[model samples]
Target: MCGSGQLAVLLVLLLCALRDVAPLPDSGMLFPRESPSREVKELTGLWDFRADLSPSRDLGFQKAWYKSRLAETGPVIDMPVPASYNDITQDPMLRDFIGWVWYEREVVVPARWVADEGTRVVLRVGSAHYYSVVWVNGVKVTEHNGGHLPFEAEIGDLPQVHMMAADGRAAYEDVYTLPVGIRTVKVTSTQFLINNKPFYFHGVNKHEDSDIRGKGFDWPLIVKDFNLLKWLGANSFRTSHYPYAEEILQMCDRHGIVVIDECPGVGIKDIRSFRNASLAHHLVVMDELVRRDKNHPSVVMWSVANEPASEMPPAGLYFKTLITHTKTLDPTRPVTYVTCSNYARDKGAPYVDVLSVNSYFSWYHDPGHLELIPIQLNTQFENWYGKYQKPIIQSEYGADAVPGLHSDPPVMFTEEYQKLVLQGYHSVFDQKRKEYVIGELIWNFADFMTAQGVVRVVGNKKGIFSRQRQPKAGAFILKERYWRLANETGRLPPWTKYSCLL
Candidate 1:
């Protein structure tokens, strides 16, 4: 019924409305999974690598290195993919390199994937160093600036094929190669639940540390750690202070392990450090962490900071903003920050969904007085419950134990002392299990390297296992307690009494 110009104007208005209503592109990291129209190929293997040692150098993308033209620029060396370039070679320079290292590889997309219009091609890197930039066949695809989590690029169309030989000795040849997926993690007033069922975190706090790799993505070490966790009757773990390699999360997903993915916002003390610059970096880290690990079923919660200065008045606003932002990223999982602050008066306690506390009652507080653990823990838990009325997790609690030390009556650094310390915490944990206390993750799973200090022998000795991944005397004590707790907490079915031991 309208005139031509009026009709055209109406079309313009409709189009503008549609544009405003359209959903935004997903900014989250992608993990390849085989759907009806999707396929994946891992681009992990040998990659040409070099580290820039110049005091000043421009960005790699600004130099247009993603064009796969590094061979034309300077010298190149072969290095393994999914690895940190720091400790791969005998050269001390390469082992201690801290600057921008470049890695490049030739990849070929599958013809079948290119043929399907609905199919999407993505290149996924499990983990890299502090920063990484990727180019797919001379086209800049993605750049991620975090070392711990995975980053992916959606390569829409496969370019003309010109693949190099596998041994890195020849020219180009066309070959088909290409790439590459939550349970509901709910929290009630009294319990943590997965799919509406009560869940308990019988786990340890872990770091991606080892003898040689030094935070590098090592598959064998990952397998060993998971095996050790299973052997210890652990069903969960916190990525203690930073995001772990994606391969670790994938294995946890497949093995039915719960994860509390944490950020590297440790040692954030004082109001000056909690200002805009620090908070901005913290938010960026949170964005990357959520985007990368959002889809993993193993991840039940996101830990924003580890042992932050929560007693500071400014910390209240800092954590509140960060926690609120994390919730916006993924509203499904609970957001919490690990605090060593007193429950009766932590400035950050009101900001988190779960009250995560790191208590060292007997070890640090009363110093070898195991008798005070239960009483102290009980009072703290009661205070936290009364104040917050939220679920609580003993995010960290442990004692330092040297591997071979032994004392019958229990002395500090002795194996018997570690066992007794755990027994004391377990006694209190059992009593609080009936209430709102949902989890207790031991301070660490394995002994790890740390900055040298007067109090530290070699490193923090709180791990149930030694640095070599060998179990200490405390390991058996935890194994027994965890198995029993899992059974009593209904985490395992009646027929699965000793399944973790299997």
Candidate 2:
């Protein structure tokens, strides 16, 4: 698995296992199809394309035609997308050319679509030759080395791009500009510093799951969640088990929210899953993930995996390779993996820059024993810190709360208990915030659908907000707590600090 946590939600990347399956389906293994919630704009008209006829076909690569107007690089003629350039040309050399052919076009996205913070605008190239490299506004977004595989790039709020006529305007064009918020993330011995100040990640773990679209992207749903995040005064969240859409990260970059971009490396529960082949594939996913999200300022940390079988004998070398490889890919940010494994036995713990621990205290360990929360939670922090001395984020906590379920004494699965569960964790966090504990993200930001299991209730009810984005009693509790923390911490917008000049 290559990436996981937004708001601390762990998106289980079951997609990684699909590579091992034979004859993958065209739907998931291929480019996205237009759904009711999604709209597809075709780029199949004539394009400015040219075939490099130099002695070395590497002329385009050397000159970097993708960076600027293809016409400026050389002569160009009309060539159609989704069709072979050889078929359109009358010249024999153009037809017979067995080298790199360059194609470029400027398609203006809809202003409404660009304005919508939730819409993730992806450009899908249906078919291309042997080796294909894609760039959005001159920045390389994706590289595919295989044939017949349709590739696409999710270019969120695409950078300003224009190749105009002599008059400085294309025949038709629309412009949308995005201002980036610049900030730095540092993980020291006892703190998670953003813009050189200790910041607490008092947020919720979130899932992309919803009632109608499921894991599919929906602009309305995404906007509602962003509204809830701001309403709750949460400054940061983990992508949970895997990386979320580029659109969400773009919102974070623009709005000054923090993120821990995780890979799809989940469910390595079996010892056999830690083999070299699996490790090789996992590295590729990280490569793709980093290329897509590396520039987003909101992404402060990179999570390599989530809850793998770290106690296994092979896990030591396996995680060492995985974590180190991710660090090498993007050294700008710290790297981590969510672990529910025992701290002493987890092979990957030593490699992570921060210890993101997932624990269910009173709910799972001693059902309804709220009093034990502080004791157990404190020990959890002390043990991990005593062993590693690294910063810690209570990446996952909180008990499932069935909305409106009542109990006088705060029983499990009730709203009261969920409120108390958070209260219990918060008490411990308040104690450790001054020490090595850097952040605390709840188990869920909202209740989400999951596979039917004994532990699930219709789905997971651990969300402070229901799956519909409506607040539970716990949401109000968190709103007050988070706002207080924000004020006490003097949380400023990320763009306010340009440098360390203070």
Identify the candidate with maximal TM-score. Answer: 1
**Per-model CA lDDT versus the true structure:** 0.74, 0.74
Against the true structure, what is every candidate's RMSD?
11.5, 15.7
> Which candidate's lDDT is highest?
1
Worst 10 residues of 1 by lDDT: 8-17
Candidate 1 lDDT, tens digit per residue, 165-281? Answer: 233233233334222224677787789988888888888999877776666667788889988887777889999899887768888877788899999888888778688877876
User: In terms of TM-score, how similar is model 1 to the real structure?
Assistant: 0.77
What is the TM-score of each predicted model, taking all chains together? 0.77, 0.68
Q: Alpha-carbon error at 280 in model 1, in Å? A: 3.7
Residue 496 local lDDT, model 1: 45
lDDT digits (tens) for residues 139-175 of candidate 2: 7766553233345667664465322212222222333
